[model samples]
Target: MKEKLYTLIIICFTMLLTASCGADHYMKKGEKYLALGEYYDAAAEFKTAYNKTSPKDKDKRGERAKKLAGCYDRINSTQKAIAAYRNTIRYNKADIETHLSFARVLMKNGSYKEAAKEFQLVLDSLPDNELAKTGLLSAQTAQAEKEAGSRYIVKKMDVFNSRRADYSPMLFGDEYDQLYFTSTRNEAEGDELSGITGTKAGDIFVSQKDDKGKWGKPEAIVSGLNTEFDEGACCFTPDQSQMYLTQCTTDPNYPRYATIVTSNRSDAAWGKASALEITRDTLSSYAHPAVSPDGQWLYFTSDMPGGKGGYDIWRVRLTSNGLGGVENLGEPVNTPGNEMFPTFRPNGDLYFSSDGHKGLGGLDIYIAKVDKRTKKFVLEHPGYPLNSYGDDFGMTFEGPHNRGYFSSNRGDGRGWDHIYSFEKPEVIQTVKGWVYEMDGYELPDALVYMIGSDGTNLKLNVKGDGSFTQVISPNVDYMMLATCKGFLNHKEELRVKPVTESEEYVLQFPLASIRVPVLIDNIFYDFDKYSLRPESTKALDELIKLLNENPNVTIELSAHCDYKGSAEYNKTLSQKRAEAVVNYLIEHGIAKDRLSPVGYGKEKPKTIRKKLTEKYPWLKEGDVLTEEFIKKLDKDKQEICNQLNRRTEFIVLRITYGMFDENGNLKNPPKAKEQDNGGSEDDGFVIEM
Candidate 1:
């Protein structure tokens, strides 16, 4: 019996030891949770440990302070976190982690200069600490940037958590008074599951600002277009008559992927949803459609083949019928990580969310320029308050106000999803243009189209003045086309796209008319030859008409060669060519200057060609040719290279200007002026032959 009692004592001792170890384990876990930013559970565990600790254990006080400070920081109580951190620093001067944490909290609170000093203290003690160095650099950078002009000041407003809401906010209307966003708020009338979120499905919601500039309560968009499944990321046609939204099936087993769906607004009521055939694909998912203000191109995100990474942004030409084939956005805009939720503001600036590039965390919002010349994207990240260590995405500007909406999952109040407003940087601007007729008149009711080289089409309609304008996006080639009934369509090829403020481009078209004679300005020929040059036929056909019109009028034929060979040889060659032209004209029954033939070789020069081979000190003369040089040139060059030097020309030297009587006999003859020699007084004509 005594042995059994001893055994019972040992068992109780082991049980007490195990309970103590369990409590310590939980305390350690609480500390780890604080580090990982999971504050709610950490607070509970730390509270239990603090209550269990003995009153004399002074270390417990410091532990409680540190844990509570972390909880406050996670909840965005910056002031309280600062005080707690200060207390911990005072009590535990040797804890480097506490000092670093305090500095980080200070930085978050906008006390950047103070944060820099704290980081410097840590770095001085541990010179090779990478985190300390990084913290110091960031603090210094923030301090410096504060001195620069604040082009954008990001302000985090109230955290929105309307019962399971998922945000993808966008701005609509010229004044930005209305905001449209995608959400899965339980209040949605349909109350369906969103397959993408694995929760209550998404529906379009709208919020409006009151006269006082305060946002009104969000209300579901009660249109025929709102579906039970996901519907988000919408863009308006230039006329605002049609709305395009990205729709994804709620069922994962569904074969069809995300697609661009359209709805027509007629008489203020939305019509049934219709998928854009050109943009939809069974094999690929397409979402986040952004239409330019003019509706020329449709920019969106896709996971289609050939993309750089997950869901790279792409574009397609928008036609009256639908969207064109998709083209990938390459380079800096797309990375090996997921890029989604692209939006184009009225001013041509692009905002999107990306996990492909370096960012604060998860999916951070990024801005980039569309380089029209290089056909590539260049990305820029908004630091600090504009971005946080959470998924920040789906941004849209509110016109020139510099205010915008974006979604984030930062701070501890709400779980991982909500919409927030921030101020946009002012470095970006918008481009605008118009469409007109060839007669310089506007074409009302005409459609203006702009297509990115990558196949994104933005569409717009012509106003009463036949004018159309759209914010020009950066980094994409624009193929602009203007179309209207009863007018010949016109197209302008813009190789490099611009991101400048309000660029104006005019496109004109001529009304279709009967085909008329148009001059051909381009032609080429061989040297001193009577035969038709390869390109000469392109122009000769137009000339044939004048011959057919005035058969009675005669024209003089002349040919002159540039100086390059012997004068006698050149003269003879020119004369033969001139005579050959005269013979051909007579055969065609065209009275040349009543057909006079002349050849002024070597005597008359069209252009003075300097003798570069000649000696002249301090002068480096370039090659020059006069009529005199034609005869001195080598046979090969004289016959070929001198093609520009030798060519056929004509002058209307005479015409039978008389009217015929009723009996077909000339009743009166017009007086004629005597023709001068085929030479200008400045340069006497001499037929070498």
Candidate 2:
């Protein structure tokens, strides 16, 4: 029994020794790879070591889990990182950093509420930890940010993306048709997968839009510029003669750090590239180059010493000889976490991505502009859709247009970045004018003459529908005159209001006829009263203004009543109504001689117009709405037709009213008389002058 016990103890000791040896080997490899910034390789090794180590060895297993979680986080494997972090906290529940990291991954996964619980846990121990507080705030507001969306219309550019990651779009060339971007597709020149990202290295690729405005299949740039190492996030000078790109040269023994390089265009293609030495800080990593529109500043991201914390955006003077004036952007722009992928608009607005800012988790895109008052950079989150709970960065605009392309890794479970297009539709101001004869259909032959304060003079021909549309400048006042043969001219003054969204201003030109009576719209009277209702003031005021505008024109005001009332009663009633309108017009700065009052009573019924027929489809156009015709219809239709007939209208008596002598200004048409009472202008409407 003693001999058997000794043999069993020796076997168990050997098994323990073998397990320790296997786990230690993986642990050492993981540590080495992690030091070299090879996150993917480190994750694989650490995961293996965590599985191989004895479950009873909590210390070793917890450390291995923590390292594995860090590696997964670096590569943006959110689920894996979350699981690894959970395992780490389970083994070593007291590690605040592990809980903090787990919360951050949860935020990236859009589990903001859950992430807040973990951040609160971190704050329980380190009460003043800024990172935990910021993370907690971010988790709380992420969903709210999603509800407040941006004006930008974003769509995934599947044509620009591939199965692997593609990002950092740059629009250049004279036409802005040549699109350059970074892609980690199979076409990349680098053969081996990147130990840093777990995918092949990203390379610069170009896709040209054809004459038809369609993007072609992307092809890798075959210039001497591309190398076996990582190359991406490129930008060009204003002239696009020089291209600056981020390059990462690999050395298995040492860590790989990104550096900026420049390549000059020769005969259309970039020639050999050379390292762009910004600062002598060889230990720092620099990437994501963006050149200003004026080519005076070269903005880039770096992790150099003296940085606020993680990678911060820095700009340098793009001098004739290399670059200088390295500035850290500071305060509101930079934070303890990463701020990268700085871009610029044509209007000098700075756009960048930030993981440290209060945002919707991961890296959210923000617009930064210098406040004219404070002169300090003010950062603004563009809101959700323009941003998401994923790594959204890299934006490029099409010249002065608000539309452009950007990058995001929102929905891809594989954690691969993809290209997306965004556009804020431009607001256009237009003046739409409709010309027609009064009490008639549209006048398709009408001509509109327009003169603007901004030296805009145009003669627009009306379309078949008697409508003309013209793009109007904001803050410009325009005078438009509508004219048709044998019809009196109508004038309108329009002021284009300043607006930030698309709008169309409508102007109606109802020309007075030389041959027919014109109905004044919106005039109303109550019961049997001759006095105009309050609602009739708008239409009456318009008529008064029209007479004042066309001072040389004279009109005979007439009122008609429905067929329900007796002819004599309607005659007296309409006569009083017409006289009341004339009195109101004369009271409000109109020449009394320009008006003549008459009552048609029920002698001529209302003729249905095309507009009326559209409203009441039972009625036919040009049909007179007599008592017989109205009685055939339903009670609703009869009442509507009767309401149409009870209206005040006018006929152009003469277009040369006050044009002759100034004193004979036709002050009162009722008191004017140079003709017989039997004639056209003297049909009992004139009292002797």
Best by lDDT: 2
- TM-score top scorer: 2
Q: lDDT at 154 for candidate 1? A: 61
* Alpha-carbon lDDT of model 1: 0.62
Give a tens-digit lDDT track for model 1, residues 1-689: 99999999999778656755765777897777655445655666665665555445446546766776777555545666787677556546327777777776676555777878887988888887655676677666654443443355665545344756557777655456777787777866565443233356677888888889888887877877787767887877656667889886643323446788888988766777898765434778878888865466888888888888667888887775655667787766776557888877655667788755554444667777667788456677776567764567878776544577787766633434678878755444333445543323455667656677565655556544555545444666676655565443455556545544434444443322112111123334355455555665544543454444444444555677666688998788777766765665566656444667777665554332232123322222333445345457666554543554454555554444334576878775544544567321311211110
Regions of model 2 farther than 4 Å from truth: 1-6, 428-689
State the TM-score for model 2: 0.63
RMSD of each: 24.2, 19.8
